[model samples]
Target: MTGSSVLSVLCIYVVLTFGSFITVIKSLETQTQSHEHYSYDRVINLPGQPLTPSVSQFSGYITVNKDHGRALFYWFFEAQSHPSKKPLLLWLNGGPGCSSIGYGAAVELGPLKVNKNGGLNFNPHSWNKEANLLFVESPVGVGFSYTNTSSDLDILDDQFVAEDTYNFLVNWLQRYSQWSSHDFYISGESYAGHYVPQLAELIHNRNKDISENPFINLKGFIVGNPETDDSYDYRGILEYAWSHSVIPDEVYDTAKNVCNFENNNWSKECNAAMEIVFDKYKEIDIYNIYAPICLINTTSSVVGSDSHVSSFKRPIRIPAGYDPCYTPYVQEYFNRTDVKKAFHANTSIDYKVCSDHVFNLYNYTISSILPIYTELIKSGLKIWIYSGDADGRVPVIGSRYCIEALGLPLKSPWRSWFHNQQVGGRIVEYEGLTMVTVRGAGHLVPLNKPSEALSLIHSFLSGQPLPKDR
Candidate 1:
């Protein structure tokens, strides 16, 4: 029993410990594989994507209603920094039938922006810098999301959209289980104002019903230039157009007098006046009146049809600051055989920036989400409604008027928020709600003012007041 015997015993113990450690590691790996299978989604690597730091990206469909063959397509980007420690953000783009993946993820807020050359460029101010981002094409007929029951597309309504979105979240969380416990937020722009609040209401109510094993840790939502109320929104638009000098005094006055914005019923005279107003701004981009249009044709055509009146009817020239033509680049990139294969996208359907069929057949039920907002505030969830001051579509004036209607006790008076020593916009806080305005930004705040938009979202997620002084 000398030193040799003790050495032999130590060697045996070390071998046993090392073997057990290897066994444990394998067990964990097996568990992770099983979990991924249950999620039924796949992570993909794109062909032309620039080299990025170690960050995981996933794209695929989550079957919300298997019986109806309803599936929602999603592109998820993990946080650029500490993903596990960051909150999860679900971003939607309103068209009611628009592709969030096309606009929100590709052009506006995701980690990559499509270049004119059909390649990807890293977005320095991507929202994923602050939180994990998930952009979805919702409502079963938008983007890559589809339903087997073709009639299901015809019956699309706000209630159904909200319910399907809720179901998508529930199942999506199951697939990405690690995210189920993280603080969750819903965000979008344009028509998403309707989608975001209504979806939040559903999640809030559903949480109460399933309090025992709540899947969604939904903490709040942020909507940019959302279509909130038809009456107030139209009223604000008219006022904004007049104030911004987009319309002449005579046209404004005549329309203001004849238009019944409250009832949403336009008389013959009012319609005529509106036509004049539209004609006045026909040369300019309605969403961002100040921004240059991307003109593809020489002759002026109607910017949008009656059914899709929000879009520009004519092709205008792309501006220098941001390319309005970016949509076509994204559409082309997504339609590539390799890109679709990499993203696990459905190759059968053609990729479009906006779906006309979904837009035309969509049965819009609610004109305002203020009623839902009232309940959301009572639940003490963080609510933020932001607008791009330059956006003619959903002007800050309308957002301001809508928030003021909430009658929440103001926690902070209106004050300027700064980014990089420059004034970005103004922010005001209430008991449970906040409203922000991005100066010189258009309908898509992040696209026009990326840094300011980044600052805005960082402040929202951190629950800190916007920086008052540069």
Candidate 2:
């Protein structure tokens, strides 16, 4: 054991030890990555079920850029039957914070299931019956969508949402190679007026940039009772209530005089007018006049006695100590052993149902997108805006005001249209765009009137002129 030999042997041992450690680390890393990438224990698979229109339902997550860290958004993809080259419809639900999975899944598009207690029956109006529908829980903190770092909680603007959504779409397309060439249309309601338009613009911008994949095709957008122009929406609500006799003429006049409909500022006079309007309408509850009845909670005297089944739909209930609109139940449902396994989310990080403390402001503005809509028109993308007539929040009048403000040329006069002889809805087609009013429907148009909504979507996707009346 000479000194040089002893040193050489020590170096060899150290190298061997480091090499072995590296091998173990790599193995662990590979296993973890595989779990993250290929894990599918959360998604519920309804194999051979006639409920789904397609043979396969794919669920996965896409990594989008978060302000604080990386964010993951869960998406469910339903393929079209027979595999034609059809456009993809991306559905979003509006809440300044709400889960697309909760509303868009349970209420609108995907197959529905009643609660264990048999509260509601399964609905046959799922949008998946028509087109390939992809519902995404957006931003870092919405729905089951979440981010890894604390800074992700700060996103409350259009820019952050659009960026994250764009990233998610791009990455998601790569994950599901079949959809790479599909034309994408963004659709949503309420706050989605903000989400869908901005997202469409971002996709359009990305498509034009030579550096990015030009193949990411963004076609058009549809918003149902969207909160696009707040001024128009609020003012239109008063007008709609007045026209429908929901509010007295005197009250409407008072509100009109005090409220500045053109300005975005909410004044004390406007607040007073709103109070008066609320007082007037408090006695009369009008939501769905032709929908199913919902069970009323024991706390309120207002039992579900309306003839309309859609009116008085129950506000979603969650377990105690959670926000029903955006909370743990939604995330938990999506992360169900069946749901997780089907969606492959169980293998990644634990799902966060709704982003806790994600957004600070309830309202957001996207001044950038108005011009983008014009650009889209110039580029020949057919745009459509539809409002459910019975909705007070974002009424038909508001949509009309917004479209009028755009100064679009009307190709045809506004008139009633019919799906059969039943008078399906109303339509106002102008140039390449169409504005529709869903009859006997409320804010959640698809939930309240799924057939009408689906028909409108089908018409829009086909690039045919919107029918005059339904």
Clashes of each: 13, 33
10 residues in a row with least lDDT, candidate 2: 313-322
User: For residues 1-470, what per-residue lDDT tens digits would candidate 1 score against the true structure?
Assistant: 89999999999999999999999998788668647664445555576788775447888888888889989999999999899999999999887677888888888888887888888888999999999999999878888899998989888988889888888888778667788899999999888888999989888877877756455888999999988887788788789989999998999999899888777556778767766766766667777878877776432222342322342211121122256566667778999988888888899889877776787777767777899898899998989999888877678888888888878898988899888888888888889888899989988899999998998999999977788898
- Taking all chains together, the TM-score of candidate 1 against the true structure is 0.88
TM-score against truth, every candidate: 0.88, 0.76
Which lDDT tens digits does candidate 2 get at residues 1-470? 99999999999999999999999998778667655554452344442234444334456567675355565556564644534566678888765566676667655666553233322234566666666778888766665566677655554677877887788887776656567777778888777787888788777777777575545777788888777666676777788778878778888888898877666455677766676665544354333322332233321111222211221111111111111122333444555565555555534545543333453432245522456667677777768888877665567887788788788887988788776567777888888678888877777777666777777887888766555543
* Stretches of candidate 1 exceeding 4 Å from the true structure: 1-34, 38-40, 211-213, 297-321
Lowest summed lDDT across 10 adjacent residues in model 1 is found at: 312-321
Residue-level error in angstroms, candidate 1, position 447: 0.5
